[model samples]
Target: MNTISYRWMTSLVFVLFAGLLGAWSAADASELPALNITQVSENVFSAIGATAAPSRDNFGHNNNLSFVITEGGVVVVNGGDNVLLAAALHRAIEERTDKPVRYVINENGQGHAFLGNSYWSDLGVTIIAQREAIEEIKAHGEASLSQMRARMGPVVTDARVVVPDVAVDDHYVLELASEPIELRRFGAAHSPGDLSVWLPKQRILIAGDIAFHERLLGIFPDSDVDAWIDSFDVMASLNPVVVIPGHGHPTDIETLRYFTQGYLQFLRDEIEVILDDDGGLSDAYEIDQSAYESLDTFDELARKNAGRLFRQMEEKLFQ
Candidate 1:
């Protein structure tokens, strides 16, 4: 582990210890999810999302938002689901640092990732993402925003769709606020253009939707189970000390191994067994998933994940 400077460490400690007391106070006065900042490292802080579904009570802020303070300024990981939620996150970061937000990364192609772009755009902060993410937003951003507005109502007010300012086809590395940030795309996992933000020096990983902790990893129409599994291997290779997943609290790699990677592997193994037995999607869904039953959104996503994995595995068999 890299040794952190004493002064910097003290600042981090202050942020970690003192930040919590003032964390929830910075969010908007409206009914948005209360944002709390936790100092994960000397330079890293995160506003964890609700592990449960977005309701009028939580205001669709059920996604993680993180910021890394660099010597130059701050680099935000993922923007929140809507404008107001993003505004609340902005307030939290503002409370901690006087430096500007130098960069904002919409980690994946999901609508929630990019919908908050307008808020940052007005401040002249450069938004970055994978080319595939830009494409995904262009194709589905409006519809997704409309659906989210209808579902969350006032929480997403003033939320407008904005494409990233900078889009890259592969890895993009640069020095932001005097700190190095490597943005990598590990093929399709959660979506066609999922991205992971790696701080090489800190060994901190902001692992978008590619890894979910307690919450059930989603399997959307654009998701690929096989690729998602491969991406887990890629994440493990980084050996991140702290991982900020898309929808859960920050966790260690070991917890992630068992909860995220292990659970996915178990599902694939079970689905393969069902396929080997000449079973179908229904049978795959019938497999004992009691282990993950207590996880948030298991009821909403587990069977669907099973069905998706089964279809993918079956398709691969023929190919």
Candidate 2:
């Protein structure tokens, strides 16, 4: 409802600056081995896969993540980056159970979500993404796929990308294999439409791109800052015991809050600093990531947190 503002634009520009810094700081020198999946619940799971680019300290190909294997057929959330990752996810789920993948829901319309959808859909899985996601794909799908093809090189040569078949507006609840899953709209946070998959019985929340455990967050200029914060509060209210983030390992409700509050608060503080110093938003874009020089990466998530916050504040012109 709130129209874009220069204040918000400043915020987004900062985020883009930070995303670039995070990428720079990343020391991915080698590709990591494939990710391995381990069961965390009776029928619930999460996995730490290959590093994102390899050679990066602690920054692996985490997008190579997912959950699945419901007797109601396999219901997955988030369709990673490439066919290899998708195939890896399929194989990982296969290790747990042979159930066919029935549905896949993309929380946001990132290249990661759209890239691997074709593999699952080829296997007959119904792809479900937000209506905005469908539009986003149409808008950027080919361009995104082009990037994916470049990244994956030969693997994506013939990628039969699967587009979403189910486009949701607000929210959706399904009775599947006796398990009820609630896909609720968190308004516009990371994107104009971001949906979180809440498994009531399991008390698990699969927050797509809205929440990051300890990774750099890429804030699309399209996101609403106030609404994003509010949505965070909404997600925190759910009190999920186990939260499955779009990236990063499984976490709890408090962790999600740390992302929304702690991270966002940090961005707000730094943005204020830049504003006070008359440091143009573009300046924030070129901030020396050394601002995190004193912070220890292992001791806390401050560096990545700062990077994400920087990204949110630096890129606000997204449609």
Candidate 3:
């Protein structure tokens, strides 16, 4: 063949090979469940989760997973509920940027927030959480793994408890790229070690479980209602322009306040009235929560929240 013909053949072969490689990469990245990603700011993105309780259908993903892209690398918030879910989130991140995930931040010690650390750990990514959260994981990580396995079946079979590599007491900062990511633990909130990721330059806050907008926040046995209120006040003082809550879409401060702090205060007030009348736990459950009835998981959490708050208040009053 002439030199021109030979060169033309080589160029055609290279183009075909490149096309095939691209197709395979795209398919591999899409193998997991598609995350509902919303770009909240120029470099920050949020994968909003279901507002309902964790279930097999949702693959135990009932909490938000977010990430911020920086010049250095990507920082992921919430390791995710299980290995599969974490892998899914990583795939979504891959689709958006080529930067490696340098850090995985657990907003709290909840299973959905940190159980997927196993996946990140395998990748050798550094995991960070508040000191209390690290302690919570050390105490309850195995139990959380069991719970996930029970609820999600084989979907979570590969998940293992991997404690964070870095534990910050109150505040830690990641000066990656042009944006500075600040992790702050105000105080007790929805659960142990609940923290928020603040981007001062962007005026955006990844409020984690510290702020809930569309859903009624679950008051677990460990949840400190009064302290949660105080923590909310401190977090609100940040005056974030956008908040990516733990269980809802990205929203404003007012919406987060109305649903999280407002709901907690409303419940506290009602429980106080019950206590004033010498009411019992049953009476606490009967208190009106009509205003927050529209929130997702209201049926599952409202009465439980009221009863828990009543018990907490009772103990405080008698102590």
Candidate 4:
């Protein structure tokens, strides 16, 4: 397995392109939304999103988006939260290289996964996702879009749901212009159609929402907590050098295992302990979370994640 270093490398392309692009365009890359696009590898750049939720302030760019610049073209992971943000990503790409975006992979059926479809589609890019995710978008995508519109207000007006052209189930591989890319799904983990984009040569695994760094996982009603645990094992099995989380920072498999995977396991164990002790679901609030207390959104998400997992465990055990 190749070891991936998380250190930032100075991108001559980024600096050179930004300089040339600055003279040609009025909008500065820095003037765009709060996203900080940095070159994490030779051909890989990550637009690490904000820790906070989508709002008019941040323009709904709260999910990570990674673009791989290959000789053929570019492949983007996670469409982004809305059109405005996606357009910003488009410009960001323009600042880096002139390669057209060939494909956009929806990591899941979530709002951030496909909301930016229109922008990419307008440019003739084909979107791809797991078959289950396509079904999810068909079922609940409209309602999710409505909720996002209300939360984000005017920023999401242009956002539209565009389903992927290609539907992948277990695994799919693409030989892009420069490298071979692998798309693997870990059976209904974070979302029903959770997909991880892996670049074997780069040893980078874009762990969509399946792995989060120093943040609480959103346990949506349909989410399977047990399956999510198993999915973490699957992610670790890849031994990825760099794991670009669905949210938060790009990190290593160890951090993903301990912080993201370990935290989920800890939540399940604590909830189970409360249940085994004849304590009600409310008792999960008393579990010590001092270790993950400093993590982002810990206060807002910790209790909610605990309650959701407790209820799920209760149903599985009692039923």
Which one is best on TM-score? 3
lDDT of 2 by residue, 1-319 (tens): 1223532543354345334423323211123235656565788776664323322232224553667556666688777665556655665676676565678887777776767786666555678888988888878888877766665554346654567999898778877778888888877787755878888887888787778655645444575666778788888787888887766677787866765555565666776687567666465555444433332232234344444454555554232
- By lDDT rank, best first, the candidates go 3, 4, 1, 2
Runs in model 3 deviating more than 4 A are 1-31
| Evaluation by lDDT, superior candidate among 2 and 3 | 3
- Between candidates 1 and 3, the one scoring higher on TM-score is 3
- In angstroms, what RMSD does candidate 4 have relative to the true structure? 7.6
Give all TM-scores, in the order shown. 0.87, 0.75, 0.89, 0.88
Candidate number with greatest lDDT = 3
Off-target runs (Cα >4 Å) in candidate 1 are: 1-33, 154-158
Better of 1 and 4 by TM-score: 4
The lDDT per prediction is 0.78, 0.64, 0.84, 0.79
How far residue 162's Cα lies from its native spot in candidate 2, in Å, is 2.5
Query: Model 3, residue 259: displacement in angstroms?
Result: 1.3
Off by over 4 Å in 4: 1-34
Q: Candidate 1, residue 132: CA error in Å?
A: 0.8
